[model samples]
Target: MKVFNEIETAKLLPMRELMEALRVAAQDCVEGKIVSPERMVVALKEGGIMLSMPATADDIAIHKLVNVNPRNSKEGLPTIHGQVVAMDALSGVMLFQVDGPTVTGRRTAAVSMLGISRLLAHQPKSVLIIGVGKQALNHVEAIAEIFPDAAIHMRGRSAHGAQMFVDQMKSVAPNLRVEEAGVDHDVVIAVTTARSPVYSELAKPGRLVIGVGAFTPEMCEIAPAIVDASTVYVDDPLGATHEAGDLIQANIDWSRVKSLASAFSEQPDFSRPIVFKTVGTGAWDLAACRVIKARL
Candidate 1:
């Protein structure tokens, strides 16, 4: 089987195309054209996890194996590593593989971008991103690529951390800056692994909030008020039930939460506050796989 390195994998998953691919996959998942079961998680030593996610559709299939080791950060090592293998759905032959972390970073950001495009009424003028991890880097890159005109802001737990992140990202995003004065922005994305809420403001109109960092119930990035006050949406309704910590912690009505697919079919009341929480699933990986497969 052909194997692509991290750089090659990233080259294949361009932001615009990856976002569009995720757009199609969102609906396919709703239509039952793609079948992706809940991911399998196994414990690893020192607060690590092995995640196995598989999805299949009529045209193609993919399996993503990811290892997340939080302790690695202290060792100056990458926190996540893995591979995504594209395969023939009928014959089950692995055609090619891409770096796992690359797939996860690009596809996760694509999902958020799709939400931003569908949920908001107007193009974003300014965006505030919380956290400065690999996920944050992907979101910044995706935003620069797709929303070049929009001003990008970053905020970490500490001022120093935020400044460091801004400095590190200067090469890719010269316009990126550390957020100051805590002003209102067009869109707010919280991608941290914080146990407590990182964004606590109450919901307001025209502000699209996306929570991407918190996956488990114990991890929450948005406060309960924000979730309860907004017309909430999730990229994967099935995965959100158990993985979306922001909504789960709020104890809101599940019936009120809409799917990303619903937004494509119908227009939402943009006058109301919006929140799009995504836990992610294998269907998105399959979408990324399909994108690269066609290009090759």
Candidate 2:
């Protein structure tokens, strides 16, 4: 099998291309074209969990193994570590191996953008990103490409982490204003693992709020008020009911939450603010592999 490390995967899958692939995959998922099984999660003895996600889309098949360790930050390591193995559907031959964390970080951000893309009549003027982790960096890069003129704001629990993210952003985008996160923003993407709601209030309408973190029922990053104010959408209805902490803890009615496929298929009401929540899916990994293989 061809081993495409994190660096290679990053180089092959550009934001624009990856987002486009996700768009197609989202539609396929909505159309019931992709087969992605429920992720099997095993609890680790050291206060973390490991996930095995297997999926197939057309001729591409992928199995993504990921782990979440809350104690990793103390060890100067990433809180999450993952890898993806790509295989051929017809022959069941392993084709390539890539960094799971990188694919996931980029794919998750791109999926968020795909949802945001359908909701936008125009480009957002500003975006607020919660947490200065890898996911935040991916979103910043993707947003810079999609909404070039929009300002980027990053919020972290630690001032040092936030400042470092701001400095890094400034080096690549000097003219692009990177500031501390606040309520006065056009789009809000929360990627934190906070137990309490991260955003209590949104100051404006036409705002897009994305919750990519807080996957488990124990972690809650979105407030009940935010869910009440916005029209909620999820990547998958069934998965959301089980894994989406923001919606589950809030007791959100599954019937009320629209799927991403339905949102793209029909003309959704944009009168209220939009809250797009994703727990991440293997179909995206399969789609990402398709893009990666084509580029190579």
Candidate 3:
């Protein structure tokens, strides 16, 4: 069986490649070419911690298991951690094990970028990133690579954390401006698990917003105003409706929002502000793993 570490997996999964793979996966999802069970979740505390299991399969028919937790920072550990086990489609033999933490970070950002590519009007000139963690840093790297001319604005709960994120990213893209300020940008990406809203009034009309945070009903990072002001898109209707607090708390009619599958199927008008929310799915993990394996 093949085993992959974080750095090895990172090298195998680049943002542009992952985004292309996810685009194909999204089309398959819309055409009913994939089977993805609704993600299963278990709450650990009243509303503080939770565990999730999401799985998927492809032409090779190997199924992958991804275990994820969104509350581990307090213990000085990664908030998301787990392993991906690839199994034979017929005999169900374990074929390989890959680091889920690395897969999750890469795929999550790829999925968001996939949505952005399909739904947004034009490439963004600047990006506003909320929360300064692994996801945030990975997102900056991914978005910067995709949109080389765009500047990145990072914000975190602590000034030091925000500054650290800026410094680390500056090393990679020295010409890129990394600041700790709240300003409207062409794109806004939120990846925190904050229970309360983080940036409510920062969204401007005609901007693209991506919410990768708050996979549970009680957690939300983007403000309700953002939801109310933008046209909403979701990766999975059932998953986002049940887990995305930004949509749940806004009390928006679910019928008004379009799923990524349907959005690509119908080719809707995206002339106004838009919001894309994802609770993360197993199909994405499988899609990413398949792409990484092929590259290796």
Candidate 4:
């Protein structure tokens, strides 16, 4: 069995490769070539912590156990932390252990990008990202790799954090314009754990919005206005209904929401203001594990 730390995992799975793998995985899922059960969750306390268990299998099986503590901010620690275990499907032998948080951030960003690839028309010229945490950083890196020409706008709850992210990102993409904009962009990605809505307005007529925060009904990153203004799509029907705050808080008709699997499989009109909300799924982790194992 192999053990991969956070740094090692980052070195192994670059943003570009991860995004490509996730795109394939998403297609496989839409085509019913993979089996990914809905993620299971256990609340640790009232408004405190929780554990999410997600599993996925295709040629091999893997499970990711993630711990989420919203109160970790008081301790000056990350709110999300965990590890992933990959095992042989036929033999049931554990194969690898990788940093769960790293995988989560990478896979989540890649998954959002995968949805973007499927739903958007032309590649975006700029992307506005809300939040400056690990997931936000990963989103910037992934978007930069996938859409190199796109400018990046980062917004954080704290001005200091947003500026810091901008400074660090400029070193990586010197030619890439990084700014703190209000809401002008071709693509908008909300990755904060904000309990309230962070963005209310939709982008341009044909823009795309990807919401990665609010894995639970209690938290929401994008506001209700955005949900109302855009056509919505979800990775999983049950996952989105139970985990996404954007949909839950909006009081939008559940019947109007479309599943990505169905949309991709049936071929839907991609020329519209679209909102893709993902609570993250075990199937994605499984897909990522398959890629990692193959590379290994």
Against the true structure, whose TM-score is highest?
Answer: 1
Say which prediction, candidate 2 or candidate 3, comes out ahead on TM-score.
2
Strongest candidate by lDDT: 1
Once fitted onto the true fold, the runs of candidate 4 whose alpha carbons sit more than 4 angstroms away are: 30-33, 175-183, 262-271
Q: How far in Å is the alpha carbon of 1 misplaced in model 3? A: 1.5
- Residues 1-296 of candidate 1 have per-residue lDDT tens digits of 99999999999888888888888998898889999999988999977889999999999999999998888888999889999999999999999999999999999999988888899998888999999899999999988888888889999988899999989998888779999686779899999887789998778999999999988777899999999889999988988998898898899799999999999999998999999999989999999999999899
lDDT of each: 0.91, 0.83, 0.75, 0.78
The lDDT, on a scale of 0 to 1, for candidate 1 is 0.91
Candidate 4 lDDT for residue 132: 81
Residue pairs clashing, model 4: none
Candidate 2, residue 140: Cα displacement in angstroms equals: 0.9
**What is the per-residue lDDT of model 4 for residues 86-108, given as tens digits with 9 covering 90 to 100?**
98887889999999999888888
What lDDT is reached at residue 276 by model 1? 93
lDDT of 3 by residue, 64-125 (tens): 44444555566787766667766655676666778877888988888877776777777877
Off by over 4 Å in 3: 45-54, 61-71, 175-183, 265-268
For each candidate, give its TM-score against the true structure. Answer: 0.98, 0.95, 0.90, 0.90
Where does candidate 3 clash, by residue pair? none
Ranking by lDDT: 1, 2, 4, 3
| Worst ten in a row by lDDT for model 2 | 174-183
What ordering of candidates by TM-score runs from best to worst? 1, 2, 4, 3
